[model samples]
Target: MTKRSAGTTASPRPGRRRLVIGAAVLAAVLLLFWQRDRLSPRRAPSEDDLLAASPAQSAGSAPGRDQAGPKPRWVGSKNAGTGEDAEASARQIAEKRLERARHTLEGYVQATRYPPGARPLSEKPDLQKPHSVAKNTLPLARPDHKLTDARVTLEQDRLYLVGDEAARLVASCTTSDGPARCEVLRAEARVPETMPQASTMPPARVAFADEGAGGSTIAALFAPAKEGFGGYHGPIAINLDLRIEGEEGAAQFNVVYTPAPPARLTGDVREVIENGSLCLYLRLAVDKPGRYVVVGRVDDAEGDGFAYLEHNDPLGAGAQEAKMCIFGKLVLDERAKSPFVLRDVEAYLLKEDTYPDRELVPGRDGPFHTTKAYPESVFSDAEWQSEERDRHIKEFTKDVKEAEGELEALP
Candidate 1:
């Protein structure tokens, strides 16, 4: 070992050099781990962790030493899903939609402007139907069959003009089963309310043949008149006890009758195309003078219903007139043909500023007025318009647009 060759170098200290290299490698590995942790993002404490901290941090701390802090139970609830959370989001979206719909309808009901004769005409609603309580429906079954239901109707006009001729009452009798006969066993009349004469009156029988497979007729029951009970004045209750020929029990039918009114429709009716509308001037024998409302129905040539017409005004006693006008566009929309029939008519006299505002008039039996066939070119097809109707339609349109934009932001 002491003898050295001229070209050879001294040997290295292998054990000492290896120890130094090992220490340096360990330090480099730790440096890489520290840099990686610093570069990546650190998570914030969850709501649960914040609630569980503070007091615990102070209690566990001491001078010159740090205690372990609360580890996050969860990263965040933003990504932590639940069924209840999904339901709450859905509920918020639905409530917004319903509130928007209510606003749209409120605007529609506020607008009431319409064209002339523009109001729809039809029968009175059940709430306004006179003496609706007196509609007689009684129980009776056919003698021959168990489930054979029989029905009877005593039909009368709105009023019978007080005159020499008796008020005609027609009994419409029918059976549910096929082809059954019917007859009136007995009939009588009584006033619905307190009247001066309250005695029951006999109903004279009328002979008529059976009409249809399920229908039979009993005609002519006169309105009662005596001393204080003038036949002319009645809100009379006509009670009819009847027997279906093959049915067992008697069927009791009743109808409330109005026998007289303050006014009557006369024999004359005149029609003309006035102001591009069909106007019918109804002649009236106005025995009592006051406000009058004349209502009627007009039908197309083919018998399809077209328009409802009404004329409201004040009048004096004796011969006077009221005209029911059909709007021009109504006929144009219907594309109606000429010879339009006035199918039905009714009239009432308004009591001068009273609670029972109006009284009934006789209803028309059939088509009351007929017009000469006029060409379709006479009418205009344009929509009826006014300032109020125009403004309401535009405002409602804008409401719909604003609601749509708000819906887009929701899930």
Candidate 2:
């Protein structure tokens, strides 16, 4: 080393100085990386790392883990979001179905209470006689000869049958004299040209005698139409009268008149035979139980013939109003011989009766009992049941409310 001056420094090794500088630089770089690693976000672990750290995955490798089967795949957050969406959709569908069921129940309740059709009559008819025409004509003979000799005559608008020829006609000719003799007898009883033809005759006016005190009467007038009646050749302007008489205090009465035959019928009235005869059935309820009478005259449309029926029978009473069914049947004469048939039959509650206890024959079965079956009105058993209808409406309403609450809690 040479003697150095006070202001001059000795020369150092180039390699050593360079190495020191490099080492300093390298240390600064390492320190900077360490600081970054601490402050910056760490790299997230791979799926494999996460699975290895999980308890379920670790349990799969542990004893008895195989018996439980491999751990179910971990559901990701995206899958969890999908599950929540599916649950929300299902709840909405269930809520809509319940709402519809509730509305249907409400509709059923209204229809059952107020049925669609004619309502019961609220007021009674005025007990005055209807305007009508009267005629007196002789009865015609039946077409077939085997029948008995018969004659029909009108007196004061009342039609009467003087002979039983119609009975003989229906029954087989039973005579020891011989079939030829029966035929001769039948021919001799033929309808004469001089006699008044029923077809050409005008309509008749009729009146009935009023019963004693507290008695009620009703008269129904019918205007003849051309339809329904068969083979009728005469003018269509015929009028028919139906009369009813009731005992004292007979306040409640219901009459349903159907021009066309009923589609469905039930009860005792259904047993009656409707062949060839015009039929009428009645439903009567009395506040005061007693005897009642229904009288009317029926004519053939073709003016071939007519018949009359008088129903006199006692009606009974109990805790409720006395109920009775009266059926009227008018047999047509020689229905096939003439095209004239019965049509446009109508009924009227002419008279109402109060409670009167009278000993009378019960109406016999045949064309005289309630013949046509029809459903009763609101109070009648034939209508819809009220109690059952209310029950269904209440039940459906409860279900809808419960579903709504469940949906609200879902989210």
Candidate 3:
């Protein structure tokens, strides 16, 4: 419900969806850096513990639910317990939280190696890894605000390349009340700090498809050609006006994103398995190169979710390679299909660590197809192993041991 302010990006604030599952429980004990290892005198987890805390295939499942354990008694339940029972209930709650903390730590340590782009919901549970690769994208959900009748949220990358042919921004709208209506009154592109350039596309009528009882929704896709970018490589500010039922006049909004210096994904690709991981090597033609991060999604032959791929590396100018890999165990554990279809491929030049941190590489939008279906048998079924994994296991085991000890000492 937050409206865009002048000179600022029109996007959702951070932490829209719930934090990584059980992140809060482990937040107190999980190490934020690789150098610090907290060893507990309590000893490492047993083999049975490892088996119980095995990685889950479903990305959305809670961290500790991979094994059968006590369901956490979430805080603030109505009439949680009475005098005597209250004490017991409180103790039970504390024990369950400790269990979750242990399981959550294990979850992070045992997660299969995946590119930052392919991170599952629960990946990076601690959210403090300095080396973690984060994607620059619009908020996935609408932000909380006072707007009661209607709300709007954006669905797009935070940056676009001037040569991307066209930059597309999708606006999804919904109403809290009954069947709601929405429309795009005006959409225009321009370089900021000056007069708004000519409207890229004529104002068009946007129809909100009413999904009976569920709610009415609309998608306003604004894809303006390269000319609309005004030959600028800096921040491209957008002015958008929309008419929603129950709102007065036009709801004016502004958005800001950078124009990435141009680059190309030369349509050359190769797939191979290296060190218990499946990698897709994408060829690129570039005049300028810095730190680049490429992201894409894979689906099985049956169109089931397979894996997410990401490549973050510093590349030299000229014909370069971007290797995106998926952990072998993730494929085997999920029982993924052969002949994976790669789509939603996107690459950007990661700039300074700040707002609008990336510039997109052109011509790599839409349902991008990376490679044809290959035989599934070619991929190894072994789980990925690494020195890093071992280190994490060593450290996180201490966390589990400490939590277990806490539970044992309690009444």
Candidate 4:
């Protein structure tokens, strides 16, 4: 063999060193990747991810999971008008608002409490009165005719309407009440934008009867709208002629006035009637009368009933939630004089004061003495049983005629 060069000898040093360095670099790259992954932010799983992971979990969730999130739907743009213009969008919004307001007002009237006989004095006779008027008039139309505003008039101790000009007095008639001649008028008018002052004097007596089924009747009088302390100088007189009827007996009633909170007077009266026939006729004059509400209810065993004389707005219409109503039943008449005119007929009825059967009451059954009304039905079972005997005791008091002379002097 030919003699080889000295440098040509196989040298493992450079090759081995190169192999070691390559292995070290590969290990370092893996360590860097692992560290980076650990330091990175750990994002939570999205709904889609969760759903995909477990079908059982997704099924157990509330219905409409996909629909729960925000939807990308078309919305009416600002300034949009009719015929594909921005003004149309604005008009749509306004109409929706008006509809909502009307529904709200209707509810309020349904729930509103009105005192008996308290006139909406000095108000327009053509407008709505506590006893008579169009059912559809609360939020009066705005002056521009585009918006709506509720109006109330206190002329002649009566609450009148004042909204649209189309509403006006239409007719009137005269009637006879025993020897005292009376007038019965039917007026029509529009609702105004605001309410005027309320009458002071409330009705003396309120009776619910005569209407068979699906009918009711209400009548009341109030202090003159311009009258001063008494009924002498008050404003125009106010009256309500409400009528609703049923088959066997018509439920005829009216609201009375008292120096009590309007809500209390209205809410409490209806609640009280839920327990009995609510036949007590009170003729007490108020001490300091401003504005008061009167509410009434007539319910028999079948759950069919009628109510009227409310002072609250949107009477009988309210949220579904339970609410605490005021308790303002002052059995002790505070008119300084005898509050009731005890005629022989009234005396005869008083003498026969027997306890009403439990069937008369809605919730309370069995042979329990009728007295105070229970709280709303949401009370717990334990709570209802706790106060049984004491419920009727407080309201069962004797009627003593101490102020007979004052009652005899009435006109």
- Supply the global lDDT for candidate 2: 0.30
Per-residue lDDT for 253-327 in model 4, tens only?
111221121121111111223221223332212222232232232222332222221232222322111111221
Give the TM-score ranking, best first.
3, 1, 2, 4
Instruction: Give the TM-score (vs. native) of candidate 4.
Output: 0.15
**Candidates sorted on lDDT, descending:** 1, 3, 2, 4
Clashes found in each candidate (C-alpha, N, C closer than 3 A): 1, 31, 2, 107
Q: Which stretches in model 1 have alpha-carbon errors above 4 Å? A: 1-137, 141-185, 193-217, 223-232, 242-260, 266-276, 301-304, 316-319, 351-358, 362-364, 372-375, 385-402, 408-411
Query: Each prediction's TM-score against the native?
Result: 0.53, 0.20, 0.54, 0.15
Residues 246-273, candidate 1, lDDT per residue (tens digit)?
5655443333333467788884788778
How does residue 347 of candidate 1 score in lDDT? 77
Put down candidate 2 lDDT per residue, 373-405, tens digits, no spaces.
222221122333345445644654564575566
Off by over 4 Å in 4: 1-84, 113-364, 367-411
What lDDT score belongs to each candidate, Candidate 1 first? 0.57, 0.30, 0.54, 0.25
Specify the highest-lDDT model's number.
1
Cα lDDT over the full model 4: 0.25
Better of 1 and 4 by lDDT: 1
Higher-scoring candidate on lDDT, 2 or 3: 3
Residue 164 error for model 3, in Å? 5.4
**Against the true structure, what is every candidate's RMSD?**
23.5, 34.4, 21.7, 29.5
